[model samples]
Target: MKIVREARHRISELGKAAAYSKFGTDVARRILASPADSVVHKYVKTKGLEGSVRRLASESLPPGLYFAKLTIKQWEKHRGKPFRLLQGSSVVYGNEVEPPARGFPLEYRNIVVTSSDVTEFKLDINAPYELKIGRGAFTTPQQVKYDAQYGVKQYGDVFYSLRGNTVNPKKLLITFPGFGPSTSRISYAVSYLKDIKEADLRDTMMVCFQDRYLAAGSYMMVDSAGRSLYERVWSVLDGLRSEHNIDESQMLFFGASKGGSIAINYAKDFPQAHLLLAVPQMNLPYYFNKPFFRDNLFRNNAIRSSEQPESLLRQYFAEGRKIDYFYTNSDELSNHSLIELAHDVPNLTKYRVDGGHSAVARAALPSMLGIMRNFLHGAKNKTFRCENIRSYARGGNVLAQARVDNQASKIRGANWYLEGSLGRTKFMHLLTEHSYQFLKFTSDSQVLAAAYDPIEAMSGLTALEANGSRWTSSLPEPLTRGPKQSPGAVLSFDELVLTSTSPREYVVLDGDTHGKYRYRSYEVDPAGDTMEVHFVKDAALSVDTMLEANGKNRTSYVAVVEPLANWNLADLVALRFVIKAGAERLRIVLHDSSKRQMAMALLSQVDWKNSQVVAASPTQPEANGTSSAALHEKEALLSNAR
Candidate 1:
């Protein structure tokens, strides 16, 4: 029995070798002749299946076929037939189906189908089709149709589709699509379709490469040795150039997200090629560390290389290759470090627009087209700059200044305007020096200025107050006001000092009263003739003290006063004195019974001026929180002070 078993095993080995030779392919031969310890060898050994692996060796097997069981009769019948055999559904072949075509009739003449007890069969030989089987099912018809229409090619682990007229085309557009599942390639296809259709591609050839390894294996662009997957794309492009007689100089690479990174990677290679990237993930290593992708395959790959696109683009920048990059402020997936890197690249033209990573492409298509046209026309580089000229208050006028910088073009004129809830009003004309100043009515009002070029076209728009104030000066005299005084209360500072029962009521820095106030880096010297508060450091000095009136809270500081007191003083209001040391402006706050804080500013007309006095009316609270009589009295006092 042992001798018989040995003979059978030797005969089976010879049969396997003969099967490999008959296949006439290196891959088939290699897989068939693999060592017994190899995965393929072990698989065949355990499954008691030798013919199926040999037959499927020439073609890429669907993921499901790894564990499929084929009957001896089925293997004999289907062997050498060059067909796609799905595990459970149907066997798809080229142009012909065997007898007994079952199931409903189809519409297209090229495709034939039939169902049986064992399996179903389909045949379509007229068109080139992509067979991608996952688990136990064939890919969707939509994907198969797309692959058939466009000539899909698989290189390494990536599957890409290339479609366009290559005969004497004016340009070549290569698009690297964003990532998706292994079975689906339409997520980014839909994004590129609009651009592809709108693009003047009659003279352009477009190629789209899909990122398949992201789904099949968790392998990002880098290999185990930290090399980029872009090398493979380059090889493919080189092959296309050689076969189609294409010029690499007129190429434009476009991508978004992951695809955008690939576009940047190869932008330097083409030299003369242009790039249109939208919210690209330029820093792969940094992106992998993000919370969204920390556990994905991209993170795993990043651990190996520590590679980032910003670092890689340094060489590209040194080569002086420019790229047109579009990004939105709202893209959560985009890294700000990458955006800063792109902005720093002297050759790159950055466009910060509206929308997220995907929507921005559609939102900025019109601008993108203009940029593409300029590139094609070989127009000179142009940049736009608009900055605030610095706001100033002088001669009872609150002037807003805006400076327009047309880097390369001459400004014809500009329409200086103020935009607010009242609607836009064109107020002043731009000056010859490209600076315009207009009178702003309210101190809180913002200035909106727009600059136009020779064509009366708006070049740029800027808001003056966006970066706070560039200059600080006093407003008109009428804008400065002290707190309102009571109707008939009058108290002298010396008289109050003698009559006050609690010293805390009047915050005085005496010789032993150091902890009376919160002194922030300032000391009060009682030895001086008058109490002098001086800073130990050159920094600003400030002191804060809390006050209470009728169970309400109020806070007073050296630089500002926030009065929340609502005391029912029968006829007298308290008085506070502030002595100025510098020409800095002081802000004071007063609260109504509604608890709303209203700011009032007092400007110093001269430095080292005498002490200034401010007074506030005691609150006369009513059912509606404030009395009309008290409001009228307070308004009168404020009007008098102003």
Candidate 2:
């Protein structure tokens, strides 16, 4: 036994000498110079690759040599591990042995890869399998599973292309595609693969889902039963987690346009996942009205009525989940409702980019990746601060003074806007200005100030009022009231008189009301009747009617007015009227001769005492019907007509 041990030791020593001679002195230097905690040492110890290491010299030690030496059982053990350290071995082996060019065939584990052309390869995975490829390889293998009923259909293809070493990946990124089937699935996978490389996310798994098209060539995720496609998506993700043993906390969902809508919807299920959306259609009702989705509007509307991203976001916030939004300043795909939804969701992080809707993804990619990295590494919430906001009313104008301190490294400038019960206004350009004096003339009782960085576009509203009273950041408090002033000129309507006459030019307020000056109230069931018009006999000859809303129907008032032949009131700035109502809010709308809405305003408690109807100019018609822009033009037209 001693003689045999000596012979074996001699042979091992001779083999080591041969390896040293073949690989040169670099092998010894590398082993001696390597730190104990280095990846090479760790891979060697954990993988039990001491023999492989002893056989290889530093100069000839091919990339991924240790992984290449792993047996079937050993490889299965490290299947889900991060690929950063072992990815180099994916290339061909450098020594006498020639590695498989096509890499590990799926057939080795009940999976098959078939290729019509060498360029594009189709993979049939009997069960879920891990796929690892080089950094920029275009031959992406998408897993296509067969559904028993759907027999060879493409519906089961909505899954991610798994990359990297499957052994305990650091981050898992799931991407959702935009509307329609414009690009192939391979291109989408390649684009995200490049993004992963650019971010240097070493131990990462990428997931990309294909949007299925309907018979009408429209992207439809909702079934006939009004159920969302997110259910299937969640099921697939759950399967992936179970099969590959992925950590749920390290997941992220990203998409643009319609894909953004899906991401927002999926975010409700995975509250622990970090959501990233670009130019997302938050309101499906608004999206249904678009030209592309017009044909299926009614069906889509039914599905949208049940579930909306805005409502889902509220639920997500309730569960302590946050979302990251990337939108363009001039996105035609987004409407006022979508923007308002993004603005109101306090937990959502918004990033605004310049250019059209399609450019948002390209422009915001770098910053989006950085945020994902920080989130994966358990970084704290990154936000700026706006302090010392002093607001006071000066006559009809409210002036505000504040300072914005940028705490984030990526944000260079900030934009400011005012949000009130009336509505949000356009964001003012305050990218460089820190100390700003924003002046706006309005009758809104309360207003909340907000500031956002241009780069990341994450915004924060003023939580503290001018009086130093603390309020919720999500729901800001109103501004303080100013000194009261005398009332303006009032225009009073005639009393409600009932008269029976033939060829009635004006409709009687008691019962017979038709043609122009026909008033309708939505508060009553059978409208336009005698009982609908309430009469009050007093010194002021006032009228009182209850305006109550029930369920989906809102209280409204509509009055038809006849065109004046020669009368002119172009010089008048506003027409004021007295009103008293128990309801907290009301909307006053004015229509032209063609029944087209010309102007409108939101009346609150402040406007109840002195309700006014002001005409708006052509350029500023949306200024809550306060005044008109073409005042001189109207004056000239009135003089010439008279």
For 1-642, candidate 1 gives per-residue lDDT tens digits of 999999997997576455434343355546655775899778775896554553434223222231121211222343233333342443332211222212322111111122222233222223232322211112234544565466554444345665556665656778776654322323223124443452346666667775433222222364322346666767877777667666766777777777777777766567777777777764454344333243233324343354455555556655656676676535533533234223234566555443446776655554455444443343433234443334444332233444444331242222122221111111111211222333212222221111110111112332211111111122112111112311211111111111112221212211111111111212222221122121111112222221223433222222222221222220111111221111111222232323322211221111112222222232443222221112122221222211
**Whole-model lDDT values for every prediction:** 0.37, 0.37
| TM-score, per-candidate, Cα-based | 0.40, 0.39
Candidate 2 structure quality by residue, lDDT tens digits, 43-153: 776887543453242222222211111112223343322211112322111111112223443122111111112223212212233442211112213321211111212
Error (Å) of candidate 2 at residue 371 is 1.4
lDDT of 2: 0.37
Output the lDDT of residue 478, model 1: 16
